[model samples]
Target: MITEQAPGKLYIAGEYGVLEPDCPAILVAVNQFIRVSITKTNSAAGIIHSRQYSQDSIHWVRRGFKMVIDNRDNPFEYILAAISYTERFCLEQHVKMKLYDLHINSDLDSSDGKKYGLGSSAAVTVATVKAILRFYNVPFSNELVYKLSAISHYSVQGNGSAGDIAASVYGGWIAYQTFDKNWLKQELNHKTLSEVVSEAWPGLKIQLLTPPVGLNLMIGWSQQPASTSRLVDETNANKAALNGEYQQFIDFSRQCVLEMINGFENKDIHLIQKQIRVNRQLLRHFARINQIAIEIPRLSKLINIAESCGGAAKTSGAGNGDCGIVIADAQTDVTALEQEWRQNGIMPLDLHVHQSKIKQ
Candidate 1:
């Protein structure tokens, strides 16, 4: 049995701009993760199973915030895409064999009538590659693991910065620089990142607020898929249209990152709230890149509400439609505010960062 696990990530800074290659971003591994267990079987075709989805006969099972699937065409299209690429490296080294019965499980859920902002797709890919490595008993370094995982992530997410995968593999706070097409990993390193990781993460304190049942969380859904590929292609086509603007966004994002880093260093709740407010405004720049007709309203309101409660909040993922993140002081009145938000049809989730080594 080969068991591999990968941590889900929260992007503290530099998201939309990092969609373009060569834009640095900051991301950290959270307590949440996806775990995969591969049990080798002597069979012609591979069999994938998920314990989270309990109905064994059903190919797809949906429960409260859980979607589990067995076997279907393209059952794991994104994961297999990454596995195939990773296997290329293995094959080049003359490794050959076919193994079946790969079981996947995750903490990310989109089918429970809700979406969390954490990158489940990226987490799954990271877990898949790690599972493959474990199954092959390969003693690869974290750098190589990150390399293969990033390739898999881009295969599905497109033009990614690899920050999320880096956090999952490295298992800590990481100041990630974006990948430049012409630049190798060694050239674009930033020095302050080390200082931030060493000094900031150790001192930072956070509180995650989880709301009660039957409460509504404000979510903005375009009801349309925002293909990461289309976003990248659009930016590439209109280099004159958005390149400069995106660079500015990247700069602002980096500034916010620095601010948050300093806030952590100082444990200043006020400064953190201020930076989160700025981050939300900068998210608007993503609208043009995603080809949206207007800004998402419900999301905007929820963020305002959270801000009113002495915290700052923002969308968690590619936007268009997804969950949001709320950063508040440890002493914030989350229980009362959660009740208020629920009465107003908003759900609150208490998400916290993990300090221990993630289990497989």
Candidate 2:
């Protein structure tokens, strides 16, 4: 059996702005992960299993170079897409395929099956692609894995800046600028998967960051799950009507994120925390102009408490609800803060940053 895992991610800054090409966002890979394991099977058909789904198992068969599944409303859509794209790349590299039972397990969700807003879908896609490639004994790099996984994810979801995918593949603190989706979509129409993966994608950049010496990150779950895609789509629909406000928000967000990146490089925790506050305010203005609630009531309370404790806090991701992140000095004791959060109906997560095992 071959196994692989990918870490979940949280957006630290540059929320709405990152959707635009060349706009930068800061994110961190958390310890939570999605694991995918592949085992060779003697049966003619392969099985895919996950406890998250209601079905016992989904059976699939290879029919003339395509995988056919029995279920139409399949919950393993991302996994299946990853398999299909990885097989295409394998074909290009002259790798033989075989029947295998693929199993998936996730730590990015709650015990009761609620997402912690940790980017589980992106992690699962990266894990599935990595597992299949490892199973085939194929020589690959992290960039190759990211490209294949991104293609698979984009093919299915059809939106977002893909910062989560980058964080999952790279597995650390990262500064990411989204690639031009229009260019990628056009390239996909005429280029092979291998060829496209080798090309320099326009506006795409991923830089691993070094955390400051005394930086401490904390996560608080609001217990309310959110749909990132739905919020993004709603924001996009309202962008045109906002006139110059949308562009202003993008410009401010870019500046805030850039300064935050500088803080990381200079090991200035104060500057980083200040920018976190700036980013939060920018998102507030963004919400006002777009007429969307990026920070709900619970998230507002969460941030207020963190700030009262001398930490910088902000709503993570699209953030109608889900989790809020806090950055504090390592010397500070957060026991009281955690206790206060619990009292306010928030669950403080004991998640740490996940460093990448893959060498750049």
Candidate 3:
């Protein structure tokens, strides 16, 4: 049996802007993870099981290099994509194929199955790819895993920046710039997966970052799930309507993220906190111009309480609802802040940054 896990992620800065190619974002992999375990099976068929899905198990078989799943209602789209892509790479490497039962479990969601917007789907995709590669005894690097997982995820979801995939594969804190999806799509039409993975993707960049010493990162869950894809689509639909304002947002967000990255490089906590406030204000302005509610009432309350307690806070992701992140000094009164958050129906999550064991 081979088991692999990928950590879930939360965006620290650069949300909507990261969707554009070359625009940067800051994200951190959290302690929560999605694990995929694969074991060889004697039978011709392989089964996938996950309690998070409505179906208990789905049986699948290999039919001339293609996976034919028996169930019509499939909730394992990302997993299936990851498996298919990894197997294709294995075929390229002349690796033998075998039937196996793949089991998945996640710590990224609440006990009641509520998503905390910790990028569970991305984590699952990365874990699935890693597990399958390990099963085939393939030598893989973190970059290889990230590229393969990003391809699989984008193939299934068809939208958004793949920063989550990078965070899952690399772990810890990272400054990420998205690759040009249109260019990738064009390359996929004629290029092999291995060839694409070997090439330098346009506008793609990833760098590991070290947080300042004595920095306190806090996460608060609003108990409501938000559809990131839906929110992104809605915002994009209004880009032409917002005209020059949209471009301005993209430019300002890029600058804000760059400044925050500098803060990390210099180990300046105050500068980081200041940029957090600037990014928050930038997002609010973007929300106002787009006429969307990125900062919901509960998220606003979460931020207000955190700021009052001497921390910098902002909505973590797409932000219609989900989590809000705070960066504060070590001396801040966390207990009092969390108490206020709880009073306002916010659940303070006990999450820490997850460092990857993979060699850089």
lDDT per residue, candidate 2, 1-360, as tens digits?
888999999999999899997679999999998999999999989999998754425556687999976331243888999999999999999998899999999898898887899998799899999999999998888889989998988887778988999999998899999999999999989999899999999999999999999899999999998878767878889888886988888888999999999999999999999999999999998888877888999999999999888899999999999999999996545887898899999999989999988744
In terms of lDDT, the best-performing candidate is: 3
lDDT of each: 0.58, 0.90, 0.91
Tens digits of lDDT, candidate 1, 93-158: 567756757788878554542336466667777788878877776656665666677656655554
Ranking by lDDT: 3, 2, 1
**What TM-score would you give candidate 2 relative to the actual structure?**
0.93
Candidate 1 structure lDDT: 0.58
How many Å off is the CA of 63 in candidate 2? 34
Q: Which model, 1 or 3, shows the larger TM-score?
A: 3
Model 3 per-residue lDDT tens digits across residues 1-360: 899999999999999999987689999999999999999999979999987765435556687999976431233888999999999999999999999999999998899878899998899999999999999999899989999999998887778899999999999999999999988999888989889988999999999999999899999999988778667867989988898999999999999999999999999999999999999999999999888889999999999999999999999999989999999898678999999999999999999999998744
- In model 3, the runs with Cα more than 4 Å from the true position are 55-75
- Identify the superior model by lDDT, candidate 1 or candidate 3: 3
